[model samples]
Target: MTSTDELLVKEITVSRQSSGEERRLALHQIYVQVLERQPYAFERKQLAKIEADFLRNKIGVKRFLRELGHSEVYLNAFYYNSSNPKFIELCFKHFIGRAPSDQAEMRRYCDILMRQGVRDMITALLDSEDYSRHFGCFTVPHAWAEASYPSPRTFWETEVLLHELHGRRGWIVPTMVWHDLQLNCDGGSCRLPEPSLSSAPSSRTAAVISGSEALHQVLSTMGPQDLAAFAATLSTAERDKLRHLLMQSVQ
Candidate 1:
């Protein structure tokens, strides 16, 4: 072939390779955004169809996400398969990269589920201005576990915060199984009394300190439920200060 013809062929080959790469990247992102967890054959097939349509311009990225959010696959996995409160929690984690910061936010979504239905609840989340501002259309939203905090908590603590909002409703009340557990029981059952503190220690109690110090003392003795309740009362800034104070004490 002539030099110009050879150059044209090389250009076409490069174009095709670039196109393939872009398509692959798009498909991977779609998989994560649409089905971050395990999927059955039918769910996988539907995602595949959606991906193909997205690539062909038959659907835009926003519509693609909306469709997946409203799909039976998503509903079954996040909504029907779990508690309604849990489903609401998952929606915030998956679509907004953070947990609901307040009980009111969670209650609002639960209200949607009760009044409108699952599909509309999903629609409300995906179509919200907050989702658009944070994640845009095609990006895969994930928990902000690695997010930089002035004072960060441990990994498990972060995970706990994701689903542990206080005053949240719709979760089944847990049975008090421990009420009947014998201390010397042999069927792998045991009950340990929880610790409690009637007063703060004298060393720090005599001196006036910032509320963070007092919070640290209360937090040091808190069970899971108490800790969650305390967390619910704090603003983001107060939470950060409390975490910082706790870490300082640990060090």
Candidate 2:
């Protein structure tokens, strides 16, 4: 079995010239990528049947991948420990190989996960048009979208979304939400405006948030509606400055 460290050294790829054993090796890499790390011995035991079927050529990579995604073992590793939003982010990284293409795409998947459960959610992504075009059944999925992000704002979110995920799931706030909500300040702190009519913020609703971890906890678990509300608060000029700052910060 490949170590998790070795599996993550590079994206899993099956070169056009490969056959037989090389293709088998590609299967090992696929498991690492999907699980976001090496599987525990018990986890491997859970997946033994699926892996056996794949080894026997009884199923294509697509079917093998689908079973893995919907497996309870996978849910325990990636989804159960993560916040809903973080799980969605990881899903894009794991299966589709990028952050959500747009807010609409993100919201749609979130809805699927909430309404229909993991099986349907994973199925939607694997069966999507883009998956069919680039990966088909045999090709290993890679982060091809890393070269071209769909939105300028999403580029900043690449900071957290595209990197190696923390082993401790749900430990950090998602940068995807924070990117839009970042307070305009020279100091390294954050604040959010209240949805109130008075000039002063409600004592309960406002406070000085310091450090990324603190801020993440303070604003933890925002949804699609919360994002829209946050965007509405930004002035046109603030939005432009944010765009400029976000790009600069990444560089």
Q: Largest TM-score belongs to which candidate? A: 2
- Cα misplacement distance, residue 213 of candidate 1 (Å): 24
Model 1 stretches with alpha carbons more than 4 Å out: 1-20, 144-193, 197-251
Report the Cα lDDT for residue 101, model 2.
61
- Tens-place lDDT per residue, model 2, 165-243, is 4442232234455454444322222234333566354432232222233334323345555444444545676556545
Q: Write candidate 1's Cα lDDT for 1-251 as tens digits.
A: 12211211110111122454665555555445445545677777867787677666566556776778888777766565344555665676556645554445656786887689878888899888767765566544444434432123222322543333332322221111111111111222222222236546663333223333433432343346534543454457645654554565545
RMSD of each: 15.1, 11.0
Q: Could you estimate the TM-score for every candidate? A: 0.52, 0.64
lDDT of each: 0.49, 0.61
For model 1, the local distance difference test gives 0.49
CA shift at 147, candidate 2, in angstroms? 4.0
